[model samples]
Target: MAPPLTPADLTPALLRGALEAERTERGGLLPHRLPAWARAQNTDGQLTMAESQPSGVRLAFRTRATVVELDTLPTKRAYVGVPPRPDGVYDLVVDGRLLAQGSVPGGHVVTVDMTKGTFAHTPGAPGTLRFDGLDGTVKDVEIWLPHNETTELVGLRADAPVEPLPDGGRPVWLHHGSSISHGSDAASPTAIWPALAASAAGVELLNLGFGGGALLDPFTARTLRDTPADLVSVKIGINLVNLDLMRLRAFGPAVHGFLDTIREGHPETPLLVVSPILCPIHERTPGPGAPDFSSLADGQLKFAALGDPAERAYGKLTLEVIREELARVVAQRAAGDPRLHLLDGRELYGAADYAELPLPDELHPDAAAHRRIGERFAERVFGPGGAFADR
Candidate 1:
């Protein structure tokens, strides 16, 4: 037998050998593959593409180490929807090499065994992990989870070697919105509208878009309060109308309450309130469901529809109504608070976009449309020497 191994002698080559040795001693590690529909939950309690569904690209990572740990924690738990198909396998890869992978089994937390190393799956769990006896930085780490399910990452920690990227010296753009803002039908996680917008604006992003789940909740506002951000925006209105969830009587108060919550923490932050963009189908239409029969069925059971077109158009709450209300609210609050700002969602994606982009499902925009939306947002929000622009 060769001499016993020691830390100083554990070079990259030796680390790889140690991994092999640990695997051999522990009866070897099995590969975990994520299902075709893997996705990642974002800060705003929304799900964007985590993995391709039809392509079935395995999310794998490779690293020369004894163990690996995966952790995802979102600030707001109540708003983070559960994953749709909770049961699926995930593959782990490090430094372009496959190490270990396994299924998550539909729970908030799960762990894969790599022997001799402690791994923890803490969704909404506190305390970061510490690494021991590992040399060199872990260059790459990837995770694969079911996309159709709602999974949001609050925190990610690794025990191997790694370097946290600097905040890039760019002002962080913190955004809060509905599904459309959450990335709705975008091609991939990086391609989501908010992510795309952030890239174009050359800034960091904290996307808090919850799908079908973007109601103006107090808890959501609270989450936004605790998060650190340079520029902040809240996209409101569309989800309320689409769900036909509330009446005018309640709508105004909800908006006030949500804004109040955000104001509590970000008293002087540059805050923007964005009303809904245009969707003719739902523009004048009140929804407890969409035009589709299946959606209607879902709405009927949930009491999501406001049967009367007039009510949908005026009485209940429409995009136009939301715009007017948001404007008033911001104006009233702005008198006392100068940091508050307002932007109509139409400024990003609107009626004209319909002529060219026509919402495929009358609810969500297509990938191309998402690009257009991002471009417009970059131009308007960031603009030439705007607040979000690189100064």
Candidate 2:
């Protein structure tokens, strides 16, 4: 542990989006996105894990620091029989442009040694990330924490003054999706599709992308319902289909109920329902998405759909099926709810793009695909005549 940096040490204040608490521990603050009341409702590991990752959260401030230091306690995850995952990345942005990207080396790890059907916790020393030689110029800085890992803010120090920056009138875009949106294999936090699109569109983003967790749950809908946003979008289908979390019979109503809840809070706000991006392996198949340990045994891991394609007769929700269903559902709902819109997920990353930049794991997109999707999204939704044209 190191000396604490209090609010008095920094000028102005700290801006924490979607964060509700400044939990004190070891004389430092740990930002939590879930409000106390909401956290109370979600005691299950799934909800707690999803909500605490701070997928789109960042530390934004105006500063003149020639040198900067951030201390974070990142919780890294590892599987039992697979190669270790990469260290979480921290992206530094100034004036809306990525300045530098770095990854912390040491952190506590939560190991899921599934081979034994158990898990283990290993505590490690904290690692410090320092950035210097910045020409001593004053500027706005944003430190985007890893979206795929749980990070605790221990302290932030700078050579010069630092203060929180305002949103600058940018439209706030609230987006929710599964692992792809949660930045599974993104090169860095800001490089995630939604994050990149938000940066390109010059909008503030509140991302609720969760890993295997975007199940159209009421709590998630309520979170969106209560949050203020100029625009909202939910990328549906992949997680549902891949996890086989629900059958076709439950998905349509679940989708409707999810949207209905959000509409309760944002009645007239432009809402977009996006289908899953092209995942060839799951486009026509159902899954209890299994890991290909054959590859893991060789130091890599990949996912392969386990269910039979014939299962579609049993109402399996494949990506193709999901896309068609979502289109129809949104169209029917849009008859009187014109503010709602649907985007073919393939519009962002389709069969063509996949041919070039395939999902390395047969699931999550690689960094290049993320870039492609982000650019397409900015051009579509944030561009002229699109659902979020004003944005």
The prediction achieving the highest lDDT against the true structure is: 2
If scored against the real structure, what TM-score would every candidate get? Answer: 0.61, 0.93
Identify the runs in model 1 with alpha carbons over 4 angstroms from their true place: 1-161, 294-306, 312-314, 385-391
**lDDT (Cα, tens digit) per residue for candidate 1, span 1-391:** 3222222211122111001111212232211112112212233312222111211122233344443443322121111121232233344444434445454333344332222233445453322222324334545543433222333222333333433222336776777777777666676544567766776777656666666656776656777787767788899988788777798878888888988888888787788888787777566656655334443333321113345677754567777777888898888988987777777888778878888987766778888988988888888778874435542
Candidate 2 Cα errors over 4 Å, as ranges: 1-13, 43-47
Local error of candidate 1 at 54, Å?
Answer: 19
TM-score of model 1 (CA atoms):
0.61
For model 1, what is the alpha-carbon lDDT of residue 184?
Answer: 63
